[model samples]
Target: MHAGLNEVTLPAQGWMPTLQSALREATRQQHHRLDHHPLLARLVRPGLQMADYGRALQALYAINAPSERCIADYIAAQGYAFDYAAHQRMPDLLADLAYLSLPVPPLAWAGPRLDSPGELVGCLYVLAGSTLGGRVIFRQLQSVLPVTASAGARFFAGHGEQTMGMWQNFWAFAATICSPAELPAARQSAAALFERILTLLESQSC
Candidate 1:
């Protein structure tokens, strides 16, 4: 879950790649860990249980709910530099929590330090990336859990038919606003986010 790298910098030419590309490279190792994480590792198992899924959802809600609120507040105070709608996940996460009878985690905790618009855009990378990859997770959960978009699992289902559009819209905004200098911080934020999720889930499921 550690970043494992020192200061990050772009090439001498400073060519700005797509926002998705930068984020993927930044969190590449953490992203790869998805296959080995205790909770996500169960996805490949045929008999994945609701209890395991529930625990994972609970852990995610803990990290995402509060952080989403913080990001929203930051944007509201600073004025919108990116599209907030594409980054919305708290409602869906709460829906899943309610469906599973899990206690709703509060949005009281502080969030990542998004002091700059680019940093805020960086946070969007983490939030949006989860839902982007969540389509696969949604299918996996549907295969085992009795959850549906209505009953549960809306966090994974996300924007449903509009998911791709949401991604495109996010990228359009991010690519323009998230600059090359901010890449390092953005990458750090993304990696820290993954680490935080893994840590919280590990602690909870223990």
Candidate 2:
């Protein structure tokens, strides 16, 4: 355990990997591959309708809602150094569901409770990466869904003008907190999360 970090205290001076580079190295390849997964391809397909939109949101909610809670629990219970405000995304997702008049889906599955700070950090990397991608989807969603940020686009609309700033804030936080030895678990966690999301989407896709 890292001497300063083992107890989950405030940020301390030490060697740490740049969160962005570390995650990019450990997760970007898989992240890129997952983006091209067939289920996701259908999301941005032309002529997508509200029914299709709702289905995608349901699948995503199944994966995101519980998984985020598990991640939050892991962080709160320990010295997991992170930006709590930046990590808060479930409300946006829930608001989107409400806007669409859809019931929040029961949890279909969550990969695992990330118990370790390292593992939780890994999950953060995966979740944070999604928000960046969400911005891209936001534009596509507007073209088809007839929803604005105040309507059904909360999840994809992201932090809006604060999107890049929030990403940078979270990325900077990650680099300082996760140690080199602990990063492998974080990487594996990220891969498992992506896989779980893919599986959930597959189950929901027609």
Candidate 3:
């Protein structure tokens, strides 16, 4: 919603940097910030505790639930050809919370608005990329915590063995649906979602 963003548009295809590359470059700093955020960092620390892991899940759930809904709703309303349900993280988050016997935290913020297809794609990029990253964290958590995909680490466990395949499928579909004209909106929305999550985590005890 910056001044005159609506007036600026690129071609439907043939952009120099692809949408994924552009999104990664635009949100690189934000991505690094989140990776080192204390609460998240605590998950992979040698001294990681079940309590710390539980708190982290609660914090993630606060932002994840609502943000996911926004994307799913947008996809449905727009009649987009995406199978967003297959990529949703909330179910796994909920399972982990249940195993830990932690209540779902109230939403930390309003979540992002995906009023356009470009915006929805941007949010999807962040969410899907996070899923890929979570696999690494899952392995790290396995060494420290007594949790597994079923017991308490379901969120980080992601799609298990099929994760890479699913991730590639998502990006391929994203490349097709996202036009050059939508890259700015996609980049801005992806960056903003990362910022939003960082803000939410910063405000929490984790």
Steric collisions counted per model: 0, 2, 0
lDDT of 3 by residue, 1-206 (tens): 22121222344234424776898899999999999999999888889989889899999999888899988887777666667788898999999999889998999887788777678778988899999999999999999989997878989999999899878767655665677788889889999999989988888863
**Tens digit per residue, CA lDDT, model 1, 33-144:** 7647888778547798887787777777766776787788877776555557556987888888887788875442456777875676677777887788888888877888
lDDT of 2 by residue, 52-145 (tens): 7887787888878877878777666664445465657788888888988999988887556776656777887788878888888888888877
- Candidate 3 has its poorest 10 consecutive residues by lDDT at 1-10
lDDT of each: 0.71, 0.73, 0.83
Candidate 2 TM-score to native: 0.84
lDDT of 1 at 129: 79
Error of 2 at 117 (Å): 2.5
Cα RMSD (Å) per model?
7.0, 3.7, 5.7
For model 1, the local distance difference test gives 0.71
Stretches off by above 4 angstroms in model 1 are 1-18, 81-83, 106-109
